[model samples]
Target: MKKQVCIIGGGPAGLLLGHLLTQEGVDCVVLERRTGDYVLGRIRAGVLEQVTVDLMKRLGLDERMKAEGLPHDGFNLADGERLIRIDIKELTGKEVMVYGQTELTRDLMEASAGRGLEVIYGAEDVELHDIDGANPHVTFTKDGSPRRVNCRFIAGCDGFHGPSRQAIPASVGKDFERVYPFGWLGILADVPPCNHELIYANHERGFALASMRSNTRSRYYIDVPLTEKIEDWSDERIWDELAIRLGPEAAAHITRGPSIEKSIAPLRSYVYAPMRHGSLLLCGDSAHIVPPTGAKGLNLAASDVYYAAEALSAFFGKNDADGIAAYSDKALARVWKSERFSWSLTRLMHRFPEDGDFERAMQVAELDYIASSRAAQTSIAENYVGLPV
Candidate 1:
């Protein structure tokens, strides 16, 4: 009999892991707290790095994505009327696709249907049992009845709030954390995007971004105090502020409509090392989270699943655990690099109340350097376009 692996959380990480393990002839089950519809409809990250695109193509999951997703060469950094173009393909020889997380989840979930994969939805009383012992188990209530699953190994691909991380012994790993003072107030409107390329604007009022999900749908964000109230912001106020930041050229393209979605996401950077303890391994958001400024959250999560799949395949198919043992360290190496880049990008674009005059001057100087210097521009391009997974 094959060793059983119980995967917690049915997000990208868990789903991708199950897909890969199933291909390798490993028996696994996925437990998710939310229904499939809720998971598929959740709005989140939309940017896909080049490597993520490659992986999806390899998995034969990119057919719809390529058909529906918009490909962009790069974004533009705007300071009022002046614009600095960051040509990603020119610098990194790669491009990024604008496709929502909701779409990706829908695709993956559809692909996983009826593959001898057990995905329990709306699971309640979900708990990890004997995680440190040889026979690890997941206890949950399914359809108003108590149930337990005994497995040889457990994979925690749940988000930060999930119990999988809590199941890990504190002595097994160390965590590094940083929380930003600002949050992004994102809005989705039924309007055409004001710009062809994403516009990251640094303004005296705040940081603003102009992005799009489709030809008729636009996504925008503004840096606001974490305590800022959404009720205080009306549709008129939003459009007024957007016009000032997006500049006069975008005025004609901008349209007004009822916001389809709205949310405030606090910026944070967190990393947990040694992602595995004994037979339990943590992947994706359960292991790390990056600020959204760099568009690394979903991409990083996908990368984690990709690496975890490779390790699990090696360990199960070839009786080699070396790859599994090195999971956390290998993943974190890329995680921290992304964390730093995200921090750098966030600081460069956002104006903090606590920043002194000298710091403000430094910020401007750095932006100028990035806009004027070819070497600096290439560095930003390499990161923005994303490195290979």
Candidate 2:
């Protein structure tokens, strides 16, 4: 196979990039190590910033999203006593769309064949070669046969565990990471959400989040020590914890149901420098990760793809290389800002085992100040709604 670009990982990032490139008349192929069903089965964040929503709109893929997705003007922050609502629309004049990452990926995936975007699923042992040279190629096994894709550029849209990032020479890449001491024990149920808008609660016990995929599909989470196991947590037990942690007002409306899906996901903030290494550009989790507190994961990936598609389009459509050369610095600037916001929100909303009384007091004071100050609320709202892309 030969193409202008070979995209590793058929997740949302890779598919989105592939579609954008194909729309721009650039030939690209996507390689995925998992089946399409397996990719869509993975539960992920549901919030959509303007950058992500706009990308779908630009690609003519926002029909179902605009029809079915919930648009929220604000979210709540609970400090054990009261909910401090940040009116994101009033503060930043923007709203976030509540749409699952799965649905968004499905939209891209389903449209691929009709749009002539090529995605190869279940590709095994994918590897990159000669990324530092002018010509780069990707190789993998499809079924029992060995296959290779010779392309001008390689896109590493694979997640953190994927091999794309590791293909770069260790001496050429630098990493910054912080792994949280705890993980989020989450439950997805068929009941309605406790509140109309999302809620992030900081309680004496721990941290909890009340969110939803739709009016009928509620998603809830509570922070737990990394040593905790999912099997130990029952649906009733999780509801009980959420009731006490989210405060009585919100809990009054809680609808209990059996969990359709449950799991524990660890939190981490990570970034790899120089998202671009010669002809290989790392996008999404392959280059950066943010704690879920800020809901920046998929949106960050969208922004990276936006920049990448622009760069690649310029290079192929107009024979311009400036965008390609500047992609890393441009993408990293936004990535770091998002990292700071996610880190800050995680610190404010979660109780650390190592935190002392003074630290708790500081958290309380900060919450009190935020509750009383419009400036503080505005800052939070701006970041929550997402900064300009």
Index of the highest-TM-score prediction? 2
The residue-by-residue lDDT of candidate 1 on 1-389, one tens digit each, is 12389889998778877877887788888999999988987778788998678777877789999999999998888776667899998887789999988887777788887666678898887898787777888889989998888888889998999999998888888999988999988889988898888888888788889888888889998888999988888877888888887677765678878898887889899998878887788888898988888799888887887878888888778988888888878888888888889989888888887988898889788888988998999999888877666
lDDT digits (tens) for residues 242-332 of candidate 2: 9999999899999999999999999999999999999999999999999999799999999999999999999999999999999999999
Return the clash pairs for model 2, or none: none
**Candidate 2 weakest ten by summed lDDT:** 380-389
lDDT of 2 at 358: 98
Off by over 4 Å in 2: none
Candidates in order: C-alpha RMSD to true structure: 1.7, 0.6
Q: Candidate 1: which stretches are off by over 4 Å? A: 1-3
Q: Give the local distance difference test score of model 1.
A: 0.84
Q: Which residue pairs in candidate 1 collide?
A: none
TM-score of every candidate: 0.96, 0.99
